[model samples]
Target chain A: MSTTLERPALRTSRKVPPSKDSRTLLKSQIRTGWALLAPALLHSGIFIVIPVVAVLVLSLTNYSFGDTWAWVGFGNYADLFGDVDFLASLWHTVLYAIVVIPISMAISLAVALGLNQKIRGLSFFRTAFYIPTVTATVAVATIWLWIYNPGSGLANGFLSLFGFAPNRWLADPATALPSLMVVGIWQGLGTKVIIYLAALQGVSRDLLESSEIDGANRWQKFANVTWPAIGPVQFFVLITSIVGTFQVFDLVYVMTQGGPGSETRVLVMDIYQNAFQDLKLGYASAETVIMMIVIALFIGVGRLLQKADAND
Target chain B: MRRGVGLTLLAAALSVLVSSCGNGVIEKSTDGVPPAEATGTLRVLLPSFPPSTKGKEAFQKVVDDFHKTYPKMKVEPDFATYKNLNEKMSTSIAAGIPYDVMVTGVGWVQPFASKNIFEDLGKYGVTPDVIKEKSTPALIPAVTYDKKLYAYPLIADARAVALRKSAFREAGLDPSKPPKSLAELKVAAEKLTKRDKNGNITRSGFDLASATGFRQSFTTFLASTGTPLYVGGEPNFDNKAGLDTLLWIKSMINNVQPYGQTNAAQQPLVLTGEAAMGIVNGGVDCSADGIGQKNCDDLEFFRFDSGKEIEYVGGDLASIGSRSRHKDAAWGFIQTLTKPTTLDAIAKLNKKIPAYKDASNSPQAKSNPLSQFVADGLVYAVNENEVPSNWLEMRGNFDIQLTQAVLGQKDPAKVLHNLAGQSR
Candidate 1:
């Protein structure tokens, strides 16, 4: 009786707590998250989503330089598939990607491994390797044109010393695409090497030392320990290089224009020439859509392979 | 070579100077009737440059005077580099924005005419009499499409061999008596060429292996051989004349190893003791920025070795755009620019012949040797495959075949057949 008088009478004004409402909570959570992510979503919708949708619509239509539009189903796609020049451009692009992706990755990985040894003048070496990436494509191509010129160019001048007939670097059909690939590999290697170098830092030093203490040879250690550690980085570089190679345009346009006769005419160049020069907007859109699908499928496959390797 | 063309053209051009200097107004009296109204602005576009900066300055003076004569109108000029002019024009026209006037090669006339991209001057006021009054009325047929004249004949240009006079003297060939035929040209080239030990070229007598060099030489050869670029709308490179042209170029490229060498490689070669001769644009005058001009005073020019040359004449021509709202103003501008007084002034400044036969030949045009060379070539020039749409494609194929032939991808006959097939 005395405790009751001291605590006073209990007033029950509040409603009872319900069971955890996951549905309601989820709805609220979604609201909160969407509010936070609205800007990025809006940006994607406006810039990427809208243009992509428009391209799809355009690809199916007879999009002319005319003020009005007339829709034509599958017309442009049919025309593009039939066009020989378009096919040639696509072939060149595929070849460029196939040769460049692996080579560039290997070069970058080699440089990364060497730099990972902590050599003297590491920064200088890094900058020296990366300098080509910073140069404008025009300047690079223009300078290379002179160098690759049949007569009085530095390349020919050097080749003369070896007593070998120096062939045209850009002019010759046999060498144009290969020469561009060399430039592409050089441009890409710097960024990739840096990325691998960063990834190498994350590998635990203790693990490497432990392997060394077990009397494992350097090659064995690298195969077992270093390779596994940088597997993710290698996957990243390979996928990106593939994508970059697929989108090759400026170098082809500036250097050879897919020339010595369609030897260097890459896919993006076809898209540009057809879309702009030829005014086949609908056809160009179809080509773009096809390119996107190809890149996506390839990337998906690349990711699957990475996962399989990890599991192994 | 480039120097020979430069020198000979210079001489031909100067012959006019002594023949035609009027103290006041030198034009022969004509029934000048294109009564132009005095108001509004007119516009013109061009890809090829007029002869000289001096000519441009003179043209401006004439424009100003024309403005004073009819103070209500103003005419403006525009220029575009040759590289992207076609694409630029295409996009502009597609957008329905057209310049009032343009100056381009005759190759462009037919395509635009077919498209009706240009306004019909005949629809406005051009009559048969006006065409008859003009010099080289024969050229009117070249501008005719669907039996109608689409453009006024401007200047005609052709490919000619240019060489350095001093180099000719040095090479022990008489500068005054240069090569009269292609065989003689090769002989001069062999004599003039110098080489280093280990079979390296020190100085090329001429650029032989280049696709452009080969094509120009090919055209000269074809004209001399009496073969047109086409026969009944089909390429005729399989013909005897065409074969000869192709073989001639192929042999030259094979002979001249390590073909290209300097910036002003061809003409400057003759001047700098590097080359004796070169084939280049036929006009006798040097470019204004002076690629081959600093020593151009001693350069020479020559007609291609034909029994009678069927010159490959090319140059800029002006046309009024169909969409132009200022038709009257445009016509007024054309009248002013092509008038005898203004034409004379322009010819004097340009060191080039005016497109107008009498107007260009009047005392002022005769004042310069380069202008006279331009004038001389006008009568004999021929244009076969220079229409815009077809010509662009033709040029691409020509370059391809020429390059393939030079690069040894295919023999001359094969290259010719391939080029001819592309038109279909």
Candidate 2:
């Protein structure tokens, strides 16, 4: 008879809803959370969402930044297909991203691996590598411009000491884009190295030791133990690098202005010319939309890789 | 939680989209008034030719003088480099916050005017008769759109090949008589070029790779030949004359310094005595960054021609903003800035030619031998075809093709043909 009475009490308490005061407290907590997020939400809405939507709407019409907008549907997008400059610019941007991202990643990773060793003055070396990443883009470009100078420049002067001929680094059509790529890679390596160094700390030393005890070589040990550890960070670095490469403007503007036969003309530069120089805001908006799609695709691939790495 | 976050984001995006579309509708300005009757603060935007250069001080003095002249009217000056002026002006104009009077380039006049960013000076007492009387006849076309005056021609510039007499004499050529023909220029360049033991050029004969060398040389070359590259507002770069000109330029590049060899290659080479002849600004004082003022006594100026005796006049213009409420005050400021006295004063200090005929031929300008050629070129100056709103676009296209050709990465004919097709 006592057991039956205890079971009913337990069931009644278990099935009971929250008190009015508790419910009100939960509602207040949610309101506070929302209130905290309100500022960021407003900031993103005003700056990012509004501009994005406006660009999308403008891309569909022949909007010239005024009340005069004719709904041209996808005419601007259609025209982009046949626009040689647009095609060339897109190709160059992709080419740049491809050349820069891997090179930067490999160099940064190598440096990170070397610096991960508890060597003398490691912190100083790490700081040295990261200095370029913190330096202003204009300041970096200006310095590189002098370095790339054909005559009396440090690059050619160094080459001359080794019996190499002076090169018109940023001026020749054959070498301008490549020279710019070098600067891009150099400037980008710093941040990636720092991130990889931080990520390297998360790399399990016990796993590596066990692999070494299993008679694995350095490459094999790294492949099995370390690569997986830093897989997520590598993916993050790659996505950021690709995004940065796609949006490179100031460097090109300061260095070449897309010169030496449109060799270094990237999508952003093309968009800039159209939007401001050509005053074709609608056309530029369409280009921006395409850039957004391309970047999204890249980010999506990166996310997939991250997920696969997580699953593994 | 995810649903709530998504809903909040959606609501935020919707509100933003609504606000963006609601704003940015430009209200048409109906506040333009005759300059004589205007009274208010005049926001003047002018190009500040670097502080290190005399151009900055000269322009500042012009502004100061204007302020003194119009004591009752306030003058707000915003200075920018020419490189950033186009985009800056466009953004300001689109935002309806343009200066009362702004500096404009020759190529920018039509594009800006057509976009309704410039006030029709013709409506503000700057009629055709007044423009012709005040500015050069050749320049009137540059600042005119649809036969209406849109801007005041402020400064005039022309390009000429300045031959180093010393280099010519050293090359066993007559220093006194410069090359009058393309063939002659090539012969002189071949003799004047000095190569090191490794076949690298130590000194160039004729440096065609100056700052903005290709475009400047190409324009001056075409103008000298009297060939209008722009026919009916379209770039006809595939024509026989265009192809011939390209080939000629290619030959010149091959004989002279290879493209992009030195920094600011032409002027630097010429000034440093490394180059025999090269294109330069028609200014006597245009000695490369240093070396004081270049003397006309040591240099001779000649048009790059196959004997057509033509020259292209290029320069900046001043215009009143269409959206400015102080149109009269802005116009007054523009008129003051463009006055013969002010033009002459600034021109003398900056070593640039004044657009005003009287100011250009004043005793001060006459004393400068280099200004003589610039003034003479104004007689045959050909305004760039302004009918196409894509003037800057076309120039950019041409620059790319020209670069490719100069670098010898692409055949001139092929580049020109491709450029023509792309431009079309």
Most TM-score-accurate candidate: 2
DockQ, Cα level, model 1? 0.11
Tens digits of per-residue lDDT, candidate 2, B1-424, equal: 1122222223323433454455533433324543333346677787623445576666666667666655556676777767667666656644545678888776777767767778888777877677678776666777877677888887776656778887787778997788756667778888989888977777889876444436656655665566666655566557777777777788876457866655453354565566778766656654454444544456777766676765667776889887677676676678778877777765665566787756456644685666777677767676464445566667677777787776687888888777666553
lDDT of 1 at B333: 61
Question: Alpha carbon lDDT of residue B76, candidate 2?
Answer: 69
User: Across residues A180-235, which tens digit of lDDT does each residue of candidate 1 receive?
Assistant: 88878877787898898899888889999999999999899888898899998888
For candidate 2, what is the DockQ?
Answer: 0.36
Q: Please write out the lDDT profile of model 1 over residues B230-313, one tens digit for every residue.
A: 543557566777776676665665364353344534443444545567654533434465544666677676666545565555
Clashing pairs in 2: B35-B328
The TM-score of predicted model 2 comes to 0.89
Q: Candidate 2: misplaced stretches above 4 Å?
A: A1-16, A65-67, A205-217, A310-312, B1-40, B48-72, B209-213, B261-268, B286-296, B363-367, B383-387, B409-411, B417-424
> By summed lDDT, which 10 consecutive residues of candidate 2 chain B come out lowest?
B1-10
